[model samples]
Target chain A: MAINDNNTDSNKSQKQEEKDLPKVVIFLPPPVFSLIGEESFASNKFLFLKAYDSQLPLLQFLSTHSKSIKAILSSGGAAVNADILQLLPEVGLVVTTSAGLNQIDIPECRRRGIKIANAGNVYSDDVADLAVGLLIDVLRKVSASDRYVRQGFWATKGDYPLGSKLGGKRVGIVGLGNIGREVAKRLEAFGCFVSYNSRKKKPYVSYPFYQNVCELAANCDALIICCGLSDETHHMINKQVLSALGKEGVIVNVGRGPIIDEKEMLRCLVQGEIAGAGLDVFENEPDVPKEFFALDNVVLSPHRAVFTPESEKNLSQLVVGNLEAFLSNKPLLSEYVD
Target chain B: MAINDNNTDSNKSQKQEEKDLPKVVIFLPPPVFSLIGEESFASNKFLFLKAYDSQLPLLQFLSTHSKSIKAILSSGGAAVNADILQLLPEVGLVVTTSAGLNQIDIPECRRRGIKIANAGNVYSDDVADLAVGLLIDVLRKVSASDRYVRQGFWATKGDYPLGSKLGGKRVGIVGLGNIGREVAKRLEAFGCFVSYNSRKKKPYVSYPFYQNVCELAANCDALIICCGLSDETHHMINKQVLSALGKEGVIVNVGRGPIIDEKEMLRCLVQGEIAGAGLDVFENEPDVPKEFFALDNVVLSPHRAVFTPESEKNLSQLVVGNLEAFLSNKPLLSEYVD
Candidate 1:
């Protein structure tokens, strides 16, 4: 009750100060903002109005602050659909603390002439680090062998099985975007030959490109998925593609789960059709297949490829920069024009 | 009885043909030769006479064939001591299927004017690969996070804890030998700053060298031990060095275990003085401390850093090459002059 009373007093003071500051509405608080310590974002130039904190419904909350709220802060999980956009007629800019903008209705924002800013290549290094980490884990059996050592099997079982060497492996990267490029750079140091499959061959990239996913999988020892999920990309890693990867091949998925057909890939892994997989995302997140728990070859992560503390700090800075730029009528730091 | 009778017939034929070929005495059959397939080493130029296969005792077996044995093939576990050398007065060369020459008495061999050949850099790349693998596994908590996921903690517990990034980490190599140099090369590709501590400063190397190991531990975020076990290096990584490494420093040992003070290191790890460790060797392998099984931060490997199929094949080739060179009086292929 004492805390509630203090919050009410602060709310009253905030209302009084709202007229002097630029108001920015946040649909849902990103995990990074909370992690980096909220006090770091305290600024006199802009006021962050959290829509989730309001007692009223989201639509009602937007209607109440529509005239004053000119910029919106959103995230990957929060929907920035046309319905919410229509409620805030004065909102001129939308800033997201995520690299992917699939949740946002880009066409609607374009029609309304609302500029969009995203956490661009800020997370590329972190995501790429995880992708390579997972690849090495799968290939070298780092996690499985650790389990063997932890379970007191090393002393009793004698020698642990030999792992395949990382050097001289042919790795095919799916989607040679920022994250994919970073992954390629790291793996190249291990002596792995890198090739890629993308929508179109990148202008400056000299890595061999395969237009078809199956062709890429067939030619390489492993495939790392780093592309975004879309109607065209959904279930792109299907049964045929998994078959192409073959019995001695590996697959590491750091991209959106729907980009791969999770059910088929699971069957392939269970049946030993493919050697192994290291997955950070699933078709339905936090609902991994039970079969994966029993499999030693596969390593499962709970969608944490982009959740390092350093990268989170970078994302927080980008979010603040975008908000500040939009308020002062300057160009957005990471504006996504398309 | 039938198998023994067949072996006797083969032994008689082997004795008959032994005089026609150059006789090479083997102290023991190395695991690499067996792994590479015994048929691969079958040659008419030199007949390998396994000392263990002789029905007589070792000394009697050596005395019976001493004059015929001009070259001796030994390994890490099989000692080529002064007694064995004195028995085989004709042994002018000692070929080892291991990189380290600790098992062979170097002074006695030099006094007898006998040449030595070792596995050389055949296993260096494989050992370096495991060192990097262990480092990545420890820093990223790859094995620990995998255990969390396997135990179904991801769904119930939500997001796993974030891992530290590999880039920008200061890694100090304990030795600047072939294996150590390979580790530095791979880590450099990950954007890690490499430094080193060696017996003497390597002239051509540019990385900062620390003559004192305690000074090296104090400056580096991680220490990778890659030196051989010797009188000077025994218990080199003692309490003072581990303390200097501090709370967040990681230690990876691909070298001999006695190089680190196992008892003190364990106490420090248990007490949270040092962050974590990745160990491929132990003070007494096949008898690891029970306490290590319970620690999630430590990754234990069963002394398998140098064992890989590719490296095993390379070792097989080197062993054959050394034997052929010794017989032809052409310099021994991986001759260890020191």
Candidate 2:
């Protein structure tokens, strides 16, 4: 009789179901939850604790599962703020499926002595590959040429306009981090001279560093933004920098949206203030300026730089691996270091 | 009065005007003529002789001015055949702006002891750059993503499907010539391990060489056709090799059309027997199979791989340099050997 009542399931109290759950729960929110849904939607998916979408307030929910919540899985869109971190005393690890730790409160986690594991260099290759792809698309007109062919213009029109060359051109890389270095490596292979603008000069690196981004823009034929989005880097590629880049310069952004001033960039690209642009991210994502729709010089890619079937599968493994390492009291697979 | 008479020139004979021309004249044809017009169209453009577009037959034209026509400027769409070469016995040099010498009668020119100058490695970088561009465009879905963003589908239609990764991909190049080697160089920089199926194994190269194209297709994640169009290579990438490439394989063609079996490839791509293709050259370019227009996996590029502003400028210089060398009784800038 009791089994029959429980089997109906509408009678199963939320508190009772919560009580029956095991310890060491991993919390998932918006982006990570959806990503996990893509691959881990099949079976045994009950392992992930999804409390972010619950009826209770975030802090209240966190407080309720405070003891059992051993780790937090984070990614784009949702910020793992300090208050949320503070509520979970047992939360020893924060695993983000993103290579960039912009959404995570790094300072708060550092203060708490809670370890953070990120996607690390797993996404670096894919992101850098896209950056190079966009660069070639812009400089060599890959996307435009594709459009021309797809539209049956090749048969009707005489030729697509000539594109700029990659070789012998000066290319400036922003951030000079893992992704930037990867871009530099690939661009160098294409015979482009790679200089960079980082927060500070990296030691043992041969690329000429410019402290001021404007100076970097003025010197380079193309500027590829690979820096993470932070207050210091927000709108770092502004009107002044774009102007310095001049009419012959192209800019490729694989970094976050706000890293460049999209309004100014749009105007610059439309007016031919800059030669062209290859943009993956915009000021407001999924709402790329409609002005870019018809521009042949601009190659607009919806923020998909870090995505590839292989990379996402790799990321899932990495996310699971990081959480497993934390639970087993083993070293983190990809511990984030500032 | 005498200047006016010459300036009007109504009574001037064609032979009289031809008599005014120089003893040694370089020829101009369709593709080369148009390409030369792109760069050298300013003032002294009358230097290059015009004969290919004349009312006279090619042989009659060559025979009429055999001694005067010292050099032939060749390019795509026009063939420098045995009869034309035989008629112009005094044609001391043949300068082709194309790196591939397939259009020119090599054996006939060799027997006549006429030196040949071609665009050597000037186009290799641009062609290789485009090959890599198309490769990344296909594998990373660069062009498709661009379309998604451009069409406002990203905001409404949700995320674009994930693309295959370039990193750790086993890429097989059909030809290990200058462009193929350069493509290999660029792909290696992107973390793609490159192998090749050339006419024969290249000396001093470390990469694995596949004697059989089917074996190469079987082993690789992607295949890039860079071989010249000739008897041995025409339709070489047929059903068997494409089938060996499997369902997950991608192919890129920067070589001339007809190197791959176009109809079979269209079938493979439509049926998903092969993953996708990035085609810069189609069997009948400017008239690509209309079926390819609707395929998201296929990135159709209007055969602009060898044409970039900088590369074309470089080519013009090389063409002029080769012609100048021939006229001055000096060694050619890019003398063809075989």
Candidate 3:
């Protein structure tokens, strides 16, 4: 070797020497974004992994990658299964932008020691606002009014069915979390009596707290769901709850879809089991059952409770901040421990 | 006289039955009877006028058939113009359900001392509720959003523009009477700061008080018209006030239509002088200006602010009570003094 060849050899040796860097693989579901989804910088920073027909490609890529992949972020109704969690690169965190972690295999994440964080309190107010709007919409027959107005029946719509005003109604909340508290505040302003049912009664709130959903349903003129979804909560609002609501009851859901049994709800609505219902999240999203379309007493919005550009921007920024913190070995803003 | 023949020799039937009992004729507007019109009871009790029209045939018959008819009552929007007021019996009390005395020429009523009483403050809450609803509807773009959902736009509508939430907004009220106070209360619950301009500042209220409409408009993000309609107040919200509101302002009218300069409002709305408007009452009724139908920024509700059945029942009962009080030599529950 000549004198310059010695320097070249030294440069190659330095270049080959490297330390392990943490890798992040984000699984983004189809239609995960909204108008302002780009505002979430952290979510945008991760390497995107779309779930194709199979996770084989994902597993293959992760196994061969040299960087120590440590985290996975998924959004939308799409969930990460147990098998997928097993295939995930040795990671320390798996975060989701959902209030509920039903879709995530929590038990598997626990077994693997993967920390899980979710967008919990972040969307409470947004969902509560939708709940109130939906309640007002369905009870006031706003959809029918719109149809009547558009069809030029303005003059002949006849004495509009008077709606029970919000002033003197009893409202029951399924959960007493951030969303429930927000809803309680709003309903209190309207002079409604707000009661709540949770796993256990919260001592701090002034609302009448109950430990049973059926008891709450029996007492409240209207029922609103603002709880998380889980095996214990699955089909929690079943036939018994529906029957307890009686014929004059109004039900509004802004929580997970599986919390209420869709088939039972449909049957009750068909049989006039209850007065009306307002649903933001459904059993199946864009794939809403045809039965819902034909009902005049139901107000259905396609899982748009967490929409609104302001919230989206806020949530995105938070998500990005968390991602930055996680990658830097710093504490996440909302780190989750399985 | 024949029934009293035994004692007829004493008095010649008491001067021919008390001079024909002052033959009364009442000219009622169409369909004025059946407790529908606000003046039906007063017209019926006086027995001074005939109900001619089918809607008010009894009052017309009384007006036409009675020879010594000294009074008449007409209801609905049929104005007691100078011409019509002059044709009424000399001793007449012209009453109206509306707060405004314009339908009956005030000068004429004063000239004749016709003792007119209007159903004032009867629709204050209803009107105030509608004004607030209209404000929200316009600010929130409720109708537009409804259309967006119904039109299948969903999330594809390109964000739908982040609307200014009702919380933490300044609302300027043009009056501080029953309706205005109610509006202030409702807005207060929404986290809005309320200010008002009335005949005089109400120191009792905690809200900031302005002495002029222009000043109120200048300080407020939204200006609401709730003041009484009068010659002094007609066109109170003129170009100067509209200009004071600048470009990004909202106007809501639940007061009489003339209080706002309809022509100026049209020009401003067309030229983007204001952000949006909600108009329940108009300078003219039923026959709104064709241009009104063309504006997308304004909401029209067919002057139905007091259209709720609850309000209707309250109004009718109040009107009947006022009549009963008048007939029984008692003070009216709510008397209007001019």
DockQ of each: 0.63, 0.74, 0.16
TM-score of chain B in each prediction: 0.93, 0.89, 0.79
Candidate 1 docking band: medium
- Candidates 1 and 3 compared: the better one by TM-score is 1
Q: Tens-digit lDDT track for model 2 on A1-338?
A: 45676666755675566555433433445353465464542222124566755787767877887877777877777788887888888778888878777888888988898899988888899999999889998998888988888888888977888787889999999999989999999999999999999998999999999999999999999999999988899999999999999999999999998999999998998899999999888888888878889899999888888887677777777777777777778899999876
CA RMSD, predictions in order: 3.9, 4.7, 7.7
Cα lDDT tens digits for candidate 1, B1-338? 45698899998898788667878888778777666687776666788889888789988999998888888888878888899899988888888877777788888999999999888998888788888888877887778887888888888987777777777889999988989999998888777999999999999899999999999999999999999887889899999999999998999999988899999999999999999999988898777888988888898887778887877777877888888877887887788864
Which residue window of length 10 is worst by lDDT in model 3 chain A? A42-51
lDDT, candidate 2, at B88:
78
lDDT of candidates 1 onward, in order? 0.86, 0.83, 0.68
Q: What tier of docking accuracy does candidate 2 attain? A: medium
Sorted on TM-score, highest at the top, how do the candidates line up? 1, 2, 3
Off by over 4 Å in 1: A1-15, B1-19
Candidate ordering by DockQ (highest first): 2, 1, 3
TM-score of chain A of 1: 0.92
lDDT (10s digit) by residue, model 3, range A220-324 = 999999988888888999999999998989999988888999899989998999888888777765455677666768876656666555566666666667766
lDDT of 2: 0.83
